[model samples]
Target: MLPTYSPYEGGHDAPELRMPTGFSRNVPERRIHSHNDYWRDVPVYTALSHGVLSIEADVWLNPKDDVLYVSHSVAALTRARTFQRLYISQLVDVLERANVHDHETTFFNYVDYYSQENEREPRRLWTSFYEGNMTPIRLLVDLKTRGNETYHAVVRELAPLRERGWLTRWNGTHVVPGPVQVLLTGNGINADVRAQVAPARDRDVFLDAPLLKLDETWLGVDGVKYGWNSSLAPMASASFSSATSWTGRRTIDPATEEAPLAALISSTQSRGFETRLWSSPRWPTHVRDRVWRTLYDLGTDWLDADDIEAAAAF
Candidate 1:
């Protein structure tokens, strides 16, 4: 599910099942800003078991490493928890030995949520994932800051990789089947990304302009469980929604789905964009076919399902 605020509702987010059938979240490495010491060992079991479209992470490139490592927080960077941890599984060797995945998407929301800064020069996380048998997942890289520095750094790292067909643009535009795409999202995008959208689109990676700003009626519970001060005076009506931060802290009450869904639908209709909402599993458990049918009912263009929650429950 495209990181929904808690209090879950209905649609496709079925963490109980995972992927194509069940729903799970696949954000960027930067946001995964938790702890590499621990997360580095185990892969996202839920993503593997359930099959999320993409995974998330907050990447910080060590100015020195030229060697990319994964650490949600800069403080956590160490020899033990390197981003190339993917190679620990020999997925890279096997590939030197082959593959990238289906249309499955992975969103990399960069920039530390708490501390907004790009972590120096880091290797491409996508390249690391590919080395780990990640099957060329469609990756959307959100530039936390230094949109140019981060984007260019990432793209620079991707040149050879893309040439090998291991990576492409995220937005699902790169015509190459099983190609991974890179996209930019995040507050940093507001100031500079607009100009590059056309060029990025040309390269196969699309840029997501500022989304809704979080506020009172707008509401956002993801970060800090009910973030306030949605719209900034300087940037009034941009797409970035501050009131509705997207994280795991809280969720918008399903009763509040109408407006959000309407806005989402509008985004889809206008930009031909796609998003994922983790549907609350309670409804499906209570009525069986509650979620899937809801998507069918709503005419969701695309979604990830599992075990026919809606079909079996209802």
Candidate 2:
């Protein structure tokens, strides 16, 4: 049965708070995705300073008051740590001052240069200004409340960024990239509900699909194969623990676990979605470092990490 927020229905008609303009810190971002980002001392800026490409914010909505709070757990929520305050507004503040260079133009020009030079070596593209690198940052919003309702509220609060063309969106034909791609995860919006929202004119937000579901039998499975597409999921991810039983005590044996991990990453990438592995071993001293090294050596697209400094260095 669909859960209803009845008595609290009319209580949440508060006006949306306006936010300040965003600014940019010029730096080259790493592939590290800082998990539980709200727990950081400074939230978004802390990850940004470390050159982390992605940051996560778990949002909880109070049905009675209609406020979205950012917290790792509901018990830790407070009005001061709101989604609008920490993430949405901060994003606006950074993106407002983002380097307005033409990435598409520069990219094509670089490709042409490589082709003209007849260079076989793959080229790396990094925009270097007087200050730092200017790459698009990703914001992963983990929904901790009711899916549909919270999804709608999240969309509503993103109007400022949406108006400025900072949020990623799916037009009817293609996925238009933006400065900040709002990826929805946790208890995501229902599939049927997503379908309804998928075709809207200004649909910029996207879903973070679960990579764990894609296995050898995915193609033959009913309902599993559906709703997985580039427009919906630019990236899909799974927990590292789910893929293997290695706890960092002993070295990971490639003979037993390599094929499956390879298959999962390769399969997901083949489907046009970037892959991420989270919930990896983080302690026991050398174990954490080893696990990070293994993941890096394996060429996973994004590293789900809590230690920003270590990930940045790695």
Candidate 3:
């Protein structure tokens, strides 16, 4: 039904073109979170190509070697698919190339000076695509093993990015935005993360707030009621099915369903945390589209999507 054209359609050689250092140039950044990003053919590159700013990786700590392996389960993990190799290293490479300039010596000196002064905004990943946009991309690490041990492993593995001043961090009083923001989630992550980062003057790791429990209070180290703030947990998430009763049958009820949903989203956003609802219905394409539209209309910050291309197009 469609005509096909060959590279040398007219019997002439195809022109050669060199790829630019800024490979993602002109790609508009999207709020879509690439769920199970490691499942992609090329992981981070696939999502980045679609302008998906947020990505997630499920990690397990191999106690033997003290390396973090990325996988949905232990059986799926391989030595080649490490957290450092797939994420941290790749990010460092991309950022290094993106921030590269003709005056390397001068640039490094200025960056170092700014780091000492604590007044510099690190050039973010998106700068490679849209130069000068310093907004950090989200990297959600779901710990599938023992929380504290695994969480620490993640921190250690982030050294490459940390050493380069490319990680968003809490500087005792405020949050310093960087090129990459790592949010720790899943088992055993909460207390350990809080204990470590809460006391440090400059800590890079953060916690993912529980969307449903955003209003609840927890006992702090001092035995006082501690509430979650953007500095500690910048984003909150929940299962879509747990949050709503809609099964993609009829339209979402404006009064009962929509109102509370909107209120919850408002509450989360009001506290400076972005809201993301995962585990939404994906089957029945029309239903998925409707729900996505509804969530977007209701002001959900990040769309958790398995299909990065479709979400980016949306």
Give all candidates' CA lDDT scores: 0.36, 0.70, 0.79
Residue 18 miss distance in model 1 (angstroms): 26
What lDDT does candidate 1 reach at residue 213? Answer: 30
Candidate 3 structure quality by residue, lDDT tens digits, 129-238: 67556667789999889756787788888999898878889988888888899998886346655655545567898888889987666665555556777888899999
Clashes of 1: 75
lDDT of 1 at 298: 51
Model 3 residue 39 lDDT score: 84
> How close to the true structure is residue 309 of candidate 2, measured as C-alpha lDDT?
83
Sort every candidate by TM-score, greatest first.
3, 2, 1
Superposed on all Cα atoms, the candidates' RMSDs to the truth, in angstroms, are: 17.0, 14.2, 5.5
Residue 65 Cα positional deviation in candidate 2, in Å, after optimal superposition? 2.8
> Which of candidates 1 and 2 is the stronger one according to lDDT?
2
| Candidate 1 lDDT for residue 179 | 29
Candidate 2 vs. true structure, TM-score: 0.76
Q: Please write out the lDDT profile of model 1 over residues 1-314, one tens digit for every residue.
A: 34544444543563422332111133221111111123434433333323333443345555665544545556766765543453222223323322223333223332133124323322222332222223344343434335455555555655544565554433323333232444444432444433443333245444433334323222222212222221111111232133233322233345565356546545543443343333223332433234434434454433333332222223
Clashing pairs in 3: none
